[model samples]
Target chain A: MRFSEGTHRLHWATAPLRAFVFLIVYFVLLGFPLLLTQTDDGVRLELSAEVAVRFLLVTVPMTAIAVGSGLWAWLALRFRIDGDDLVVETGLLRKRRRSIPISRVQAIDLVRPLVTRVFALAEVRVELAGGEQSEIALRYLGRRSAQQLRAELLARAAGLPGHTPEAPERHLWRVPFGALLGSLVLRLPVLGAALLFFASLVFLVMYAEGGMLAVAVPVLLGLIRAVIAPMVMYANFTVATSPDGIRLRYGLLETRMQTLPPGRVQAVSIVEPMIWKAIGWARVEVTVAGYAGERQALSSTLLPVAPRHVALHLVSQVFPGTHIDAVPLLPASSKAVSVDRADGAGTDDVVFVSRHGWPCRRTDVIAHARAQSVRLTANPLQRLLGLATVHVDAPPGPVQVAASDRDLGEARAIVESTARRAQAARRAGGDPTHWAAR
Target chain B: MAAPPVYRADQAFAPGNGLRWSPNSKRHTWHRLLAAALWAVPVGAVGEFIVWRNGGGPVAAAMWIVAVVLGVVLAGTVAELDRRSLGYAERAEDLIVMHGVFVKRLIVVPYGRMQFVDVTAGLLERWMGIATVRMHTAAAATDATIPGLPAAEAAHLRDRLAQKGEERSMGL
Candidate 1:
């Protein structure tokens, strides 16, 4: 496991974000005196030399700190694999050299941000066998280099290498652009939370101080930008899978990359988000050994928002020979176990007793829970539509199966049953066919 | 039937286990005992800081050590009880380790679930002639660790786990 590829460092793409942080501090420092000035009445203060010296004194250190920190960060990362040893050389004064054997490099992926896509660059991350992180990262490399590194690692592992991944055929599910927009429009909770925050701020200001009524419109405009930002960031989000693994890249400012080993995938989940209830979109993700390059860092997301039927089809295509459709879902039959009741009713893992059922959009914990991020989610519409979904998420390599039970109880039951069945099968010579639902 | 040394030497893998499971290092009596002892160090360190700040009087320092030790010992008893209650397993097709000082755990790591098994010895562990053996299961939470194991024995255990896991995966 060695890296003999052309070596290069991280690009200067993150400068804008660094500058933005600097500007914020600079203005805050500058704003302190202006706020003091407004309290001084109509007289303008003269530009005194003492103030000039104070400003310079602060500015020099502030600039150096900003520049120095960014430089160190940019310099710390040098991702390479020489022969069999994968290298991660980082740090400023005291250098840290961490290396893993090539065989230890389990999974790898290429991440392209929405912006990086335009420039045609990808950040390649190599995941090691142990630890909770990807371990090494090479930021903003040409697509070819990412491909070549992936190939070399796979080949060294005695697995197939040099197989260029053709991007999955897009629009297989064919989710309409208008449908996406409508779902965005229907996401009232987000809009409501934003409006409520703004209104409260205004009410607080008007009733209390009442002075900043002058900058109201500009503040309102800024508020709108904040509201629409997340939707746009994830709007064009999509995933394209290759035979080797799953590759996902999305986001506006912050780009991300995730790669899963086909063998390490313990389980996968096909998620149907609540907002897309009417349109029926589902996303797929595989649970791997180490998780990183994710928006939800603590947890894993296969594809945050994708069409449902397409997701199922994609899963069958990827894993192969597994039941993909509804195969006698036992959960809907009220056979799943319940853990507790909201109001402390039955001692047995009480089935959620709410006849009106649960809030459609919710998350659930798993049998072998990894992070506290274990959740079962559905949208508001999915709630009203009388379909609740539960997924048992194991942190890294839990079974990647989704059983859409009628209620929370059913989901829990199915998961327990599946786990028991899996354990039984493993004991019985680990026959894959043992898992194929009769 | 008495289970064979859950691990063995000279043999690549063994057959005949009905089930396997992997659980993270589950809390044991030893772990509970260790956690209790850890609390005393912090207490002693802070008390040392206080003694240093004041006049370095042997009597005062000795008195502080007794008080801190007593308090930690009392607290540790309760904490150990709590720690013992929580346990987890990395269940697999072949092997399982039941762990818990508190909420008892049975983590089963079957042969197939053991992805990679390694025996590692750090400076101290090496000097002590002990090593840490890790078994990675397919499931994230399903892993097993047998720590403070003699180094020679740890190597034997790692080889056995890997061989058994691989053999089972290959349907041996």
Candidate 2:
């Protein structure tokens, strides 16, 4: 369990589970078409001895290769803690050695895909503060070992002394299944899809048109993917706070536990879809530095659905002393009322908040110190209107903090003030490297 | 609606804030023109070829010539204006880059937020003795690029920005 002492190998189940995952993909890709083939009489293809031999000939070698490579990869991969760095050695012939400094570790996530979960295995992903390639993934570790390794890495990253156990998590909130399903139903896309389905059904009944099948089938598929998929993924959503950071655990088929360390959240946005307003519900999303490109989707969601007030409480907890309601929100310039709503931007000692978007409203909050840059932009039309937009830039993620269509002078003031506040905050900011030492 | 807030030339953070905006080298205009020509020539030839293949009379040929001329003039005018608009200023805590004629944009990136500074020169730029200095921060949205600086100035600016970035380095 002491990860600092010796090199660690993945769980023995890794190879078999990895091979099983590959075989599933191969079957779906290669076998589906063959199974779906029909004769002139529309009877599905039967597995004759020749077909059986062919299938065996193909799959037998594929099984061997998959299992062989999986075992080989498992044999080649070795990781260990060396002083201040976590070194991972991989590759067989053209060897690769990646040594990541503990101080630079942004996050450590434990992911259990469905197949791996069946074997009580999880993948440990270490995200560093850099580009997309900065992540190191150790696939298929024993579930308990994965958790222990995560705790150890996080403790080391937080500058804790040797052998500190994982911090006790204080359960903050859990989304009820009824609320999760209700929230999904209330979504704009789902509601629209439902309406479309009903409309098409009526059309089909009244007109008896075969053409409607084309449209209905795709809509049903989209409904399954967009609505049902998230419903399953966000089931049993729970959030807990600890010294390691905010811990999020959720998923139905494939569970994941993600830790967002202190000072790592670059920006936060509380989103309230129009329909959800009736139920007083909102979703919280955040932007972290390293969760970019493909990983941005599921990882950025802090809370899938929560009551409006609970969401506010979670945001406050994430930012410690900052309270959304306490900040005096200034109205957008009178000139901007026609284009943008009166709700604009506000800033206090710690964070800057900007309210924008419509129907699906978003309130973006960013710590003054976390702002990477400040931008002021105006198109020819905006210039004529004497209005500009101020963008408080953060890392690439869903959270975008911008006050659009503000009076030019006010926009200029925002840019100057935000930059000044950011500079001062950085000067006063605590040392992030030694988070626990502080 | 309210007669638009009085537009001021010297707003605090405006591109025209009376800060000494260091413009790109004038040679950049010629470089841009050459780059434009590299594309225009082939496109013009294709257009002429199509006209000839279609057996269009001298009138069509004349119109094509006029169109090509207008395009070149437009490109030249844009290049000159863009060159004029491209400028940067070194503020106390941040570096400001401003460009664009139609949609003027000014971005202020604090030195502490800069992850790295890159100086790059394309073949055309190298031939024209110019390079570009780009500053990257943790945020990919930070678009801080000052192009068409004299090669030496670009190198000097890169070194200076890198040093400032180091001195103010705060990890994300």
Candidate 3:
């Protein structure tokens, strides 16, 4: 079927709402001048209501003009799906056109602000595969249409034929309230942050005794809020598998739905924080290209908090046919212990899985074909314990999944074997005809 | 046809012929120099204004000038040395980018995993006729880039990389 050539405008209700937002922003900016004025002596002083009234006469018209232009720009904007690409054209004076191929669409996120939610509308944001600031956002779409558009983009990107059987979506897991609260309380970072906050508060109270309660009360509330925010986000977190990819739905006050497609996931990491160690709870996260921009440091959490078995199960889905804890890692009593670390790193085709944690444990696994790079590192304490760490570098993410504290020689061996296996896998998979073709 | 040769799981594998390292264009030196000058302008202007207003004498002025000159020279030398250290090698299945002088870094991006290749140039780079080619892969650690290539070469490389990426991505 041929796609329509004509441009499609946004929902009609968007223009007035957009204009209202513009007016709010303009008035807020204009208020700066309204509240303060420069005196002849060059000192800025607060203005009275009489002066504010005088300023509003000029400010009101300026705001009206700004809103009028913003409405015009919004009206001029139009988008259409042409062939396999989503095309957007905007700007009344200097026209800007963008066409994003459906295949390049990496992720589509649906966000509903309080205002939009009241109107049963949502903002659809589409992220493309490469480039900084590669996002096409359509604000204020009817909730149902927004969801349909998201599904369509995802379906197209996956190259699924129309009328494919609807795979019954299954809920894989949900974050239990008990576990969510435990995760929040047991998080080492939050504890450390709280400690620092109290430490500074005590120091300030002792150093500056004036109005201590005034400062302490707000800061204390802020710290509590900071900790509670993430807890609330994970309160009812749910993971579901669909035809497109994985569906993540969570958040208490605001609901956000993110669809992550297959193969877009760069790396999967399961982190067991120190406090959560005894309970065997871990958080699973994945880094996807373009999601974190060029820095590539931020990771989107797949499971906010889950049991070790559940977390690993979720991770295995990303790396099909790979088991986390089933493989045999080099034991401390291996014969390779006596050999030089470098020499022990002899080739072996088997998958080297490293499981580590004292208070918390994490088992990271990658198929030889999927392994990126392997390195061995030994800290002072680990060296004293005759142990070394094998860090398997995946794509960009905050979590560095590593085999921590193995016998030095065994760690080296694991690194070497992993590298060799990865190379062999690459050759076998990459070159279909092999050397004969060449 | 004979079977494809198979390596023992233990055998060491080296990706490329240990040769043919291509360095970026020398024009990057001028581009870096211009950037350094532009950066120094604001600092120098602000310092001069503050010193003059505070009734500073000739020694302060001279010292500021020396510092500015030293900064520019240091930046230029580092830029040139860094440019020299940057090199890239493209194999059938992967691209390797080697860089850094004191602490070397070698990044290998598999073609099959490459998402896209971006060719970009800033105003200074455009004026100098050089562009930067960035290769995006599934893993952030393996993302490789070649800066200061001639614009034509950069564009050509971009197309070639994209084609190779597509051909190999099929295995994925």
Candidate 4:
């Protein structure tokens, strides 16, 4: 449990197996040319044996050297936490060393691939504030040790006590199995596959061609894969807010533990898919500056599935002044500008809100000060209908939030005023040095 | 509250062109000319060799000569136009960069939003005594790169941008 102690090596048993796997993959790739020569011509087939002998003559000694180096690397690779820094040293000949300040650590993730999972081992990836190249990884630790180190590293990075008295782990929400699986299978992919399968069946009946099997089988396989992957990845999805920060633990096969500190999240969005909307469900996602370097598909997800109200509450946790509830914001009319309405929708300065949807209702809001830029668009159909979409952009993040189908005049006014408000807010709060005093 | 500023797409924010300066005209022209020759020489040689080997007759050989001439002319013209269109302005809190020939693009990067500023020079640029200044923000789309500035000017811009970025990026 003492992470700050002297030095530690990875699980020793996995080293030899990892080295063997690496060699196997290397040989398979190298032997491909020989295989191709044997298939192409008989004269070349004789030369293939000579090539194989020459290859072994060179690679056998090379493999021996590599194995020797691998053993040395296993013995030499060591890590320690000294003061506020995590120091890792490896390589016998080149002798590489890396020291990462805990303060600069943005995220600590635990990944267990299929092979590693069988052995009950995990790999810890530490991402620093510096872009992608700044990542440091420690591979093949026992599952329990990996989890403990992830927590310790995250707490240290966020400048919080590793074990706080008041910091009890509070379970906020866990996605239900039915809802999670429903969200995955109810997407356009299944519908598309169904339509394609029907068309292929009709074509096969008409022409009696064997090509239909080629198309239908692959399409069916892809549909099955798409459904199963997310279902497995989000099987035990859960989110919570601890003193250290927002802690997320999910995945059935390859489990991951992620911590996102306050203020590190640049922007957040609450997305309710068409299918999920009918059931009053939503997903919350965020964008973090540190992890933006390498785009991980599902890294910034705050909540996989939650009720609309619960998702909104989580949004408020990250972005203090924002909410998704219906307030006395401006309401735009269909025909002419409506200043007469008690709650002026086509007016400026009250609140930025856009409401749309028929079977499902969608409302979007962005505080004036937090908006990076505001854009107004009116397609030909919308232009004819006198409606437009207002897109409020914040700093670059994983998720984007926009309000579609509003009165054109109101949309224009809202975007212009929002931009002005953003400029004024930046000017006023130009100095936050005193406020952020640690 | 007063009325907010309304933006019109056609009317861009006009920067102070009088205060802006272009790269050294003579040196830039030579740089583009040399680059065009570098591209033209290899293609011309290959084309001439292919035509000779194929016995494509004198007309085909003449066509290769014309193609090489056209390629050199097109590269040189585009480079000249690109050099003319590129410009940069330094405001109190932001840097504005504008460039493009057919479709104009204007980028405004606030000093507070700047994550880092870098100055780099490739081999040709170094030989020409020029460098490129790149300003990076947390948003990948907001990056602004200005090439063909004197090495000294590029360095000065880098230092000033770093200073302002540090001073302004105090909060978030």
Candidate number with the higher lDDT (2 or 4): 2
Give the best candidate by DockQ: 2
Query: Candidate 4's residue-wise lDDT over A269-379, tens digit each?
Result: 566666778777887767665564444565867787888888888777665555546455555445433222222222123224444443333444444434443444555
TM-scores across all candidates? 0.53, 0.93, 0.66, 0.71
Model 4 accuracy (lDDT, Cα): 0.66
Per-residue lDDT of B1-172 in model 2, one digit per residue for the tens?
A: 1222333534734554457888999988888888877877888889999999999999998899789878888888899999888789998788998888999888999999999999999999999999989999888889999889999999999999999989999988
Which portions of model 4 show Cα errors greater than 4 Å? A11-74, A91-95, A113-121, A161-166, A198-209, A269-281, A292-295, A298-300, A324-437, B1-10, B16-30, B48-71, B169-172
lDDT tens digits by residue: candidate 3, B1-172: 2322343322211223455678899898888988999999998888888889999998998889789979998999999998987888787656767666544444556666676789999998998899999986555555477889999999999998989878767332
Off by over 4 Å in 3: A1-6, A27-63, A161-167, A192-222, A293-299, A331-395, A401-438, B1-107, B111-140, B143-172
Instruction: Grade the docking of candidate 1.
Output: incorrect
lDDT of 4 at A7: 85
Residue A307 CA error for candidate 2 (Å)?
A: 1.3
Question: All models, DockQ values?
Answer: 0.08, 0.48, 0.12, 0.13
The weakest ten consecutive residues by lDDT in model 4 chain A span A339-348
lDDT of 2 by residue, A309-339 (tens): 9999989987877899788878776665343
Worst 10 residues of 3 chain A by lDDT: A339-348
How far off is residue A78 in model 2, in Å?
0.5
The alpha-carbon lDDT assigned to residue B94 of candidate 3 equals: 66
